[model samples]
Target: MSIHLFNKRTALMLTLAATLTACGSDNDDNMTEPPPPQPEPMEYSYDITVVNLTHEQPLSPITAVLHADGKMWDIGMSSSIALEKLAEGGDNTDFISQESVIANASAQGPLMPGLSETLTITTTDELATHLTMVSMLVNTNDAFSGLTNLELSTLDVDATMSWHLAVYDAGTEANTEAMGTIPGPADGGTGYSMIRDDVDRVSMHSGVVSQDDGLMSSVLTQAHRFDNPSIKLTITRTK
Candidate 1:
């Protein structure tokens, strides 16, 4: 009888131990954690080359933006205040800060006519497929050039794309080319003002009618006159 009782007790103890072991194993599983999720990888990179194509116009420090489809400025549309400042003063601060930019870059200084400079940009997303570059013709009143809303998806790695940009009038001010109204080395005049003295929409810049071209009040000379394709822009994917 004692043997029988001992066997029964031992069996009960074994079952209890098995039950506890099973519970402990489940607890361990509950406490264990899964690995963290990984982030999506990005693609594509670019190297932009801007060649100042004008004869004497000193281009402002160039600005390049990487974003989705859309332009930084448009003809017939009112310009952004950022563009206004850039056109008037050659200031790139606000232009660089404009929203919708996935990535951007700027030249260290002005790209003198007949000269060239390069700016580079990288993106984590190849989906970022549009490009815009802008700079002012420093010797004129609100004359700016660069490509806008250009599609970049078709450009392949190590490949290059180019454009001959045209000058546009921001229409924020008159092309008086008058003294103290023009910025850049020619006059080093006022860059920006609160006055909206010209047509409020952008349009093809009537090539500068400098002091030599009959705008007697013009502070600019014949050397400052310019035309379309004032600059050559090349964008290459480096990585």
Candidate 2:
């Protein structure tokens, strides 16, 4: 057959398939004829702003992932090994590439205390409807800040959404704020360890009890301590 005839035949088959899938829905009733082939999916873009509100803790480079179905982290569960790397070492490369994510972005440097940073992610899938933001509070051990399973459907394009996010204890490492365990400016010590300590499951951070607050083994002073909602996150659907 001629190329034009073959093309027409292929388009006719696709239209038939789509009509069958619609199964007499209202959409099918309206489609009396086949429409032109669709282009690739449109991209959805968003800007995520993270403000570090701690007294002295510096946030590691922010990790933002866009997925269709689920959260990257959850409370009362042991973190994934990828999460352990990000939580303990401020490395998001592995976490964002985890199979759970469809699209991802990360900030370049630490968001210092009282400072802010913005990370942007774009997805071509309309199925991408959930957001998860993650970053480490690098002055301590296994303490990280961010949100999981933040539904983004109700938010309209060009509208802004904000949240005061809480911190979490990644149950991969011990919270011993000793002299050489922290990996931030406060300690410049080691990052990931194979040992599992503390409650072996994720939970709300109890806030740091530094040396000044009577954790005798904690090398951190009052300056290294922090409370809830350490990060102010504002998300705007840019496109």
Ten-residue stretch with the least lDDT total in model 2: 25-34
Evaluate model 2: give its TM-score: 0.82
Model 1, position 189: C-alpha lDDT score: 93
TM-score of each: 0.82, 0.82
Worst 10 residues of 1 by lDDT: 29-38
Candidate 1 global TM-score: 0.82
CA lDDT, candidate 2, residue 120: 87
Per-residue lDDT over 143-239 for candidate 1, one digit per residue giving the tens place of the 0 to 100 score: 8988888888788788987778889999999888889998888898999887889999999998888888787888888898777889988888887
- Per-residue error for 7 in candidate 2, Å, reads 16
- Candidate 2 structure quality by residue, lDDT tens digits, 5-81: 99999999999887776775655666554476899777789999999999999998988988877767788887888
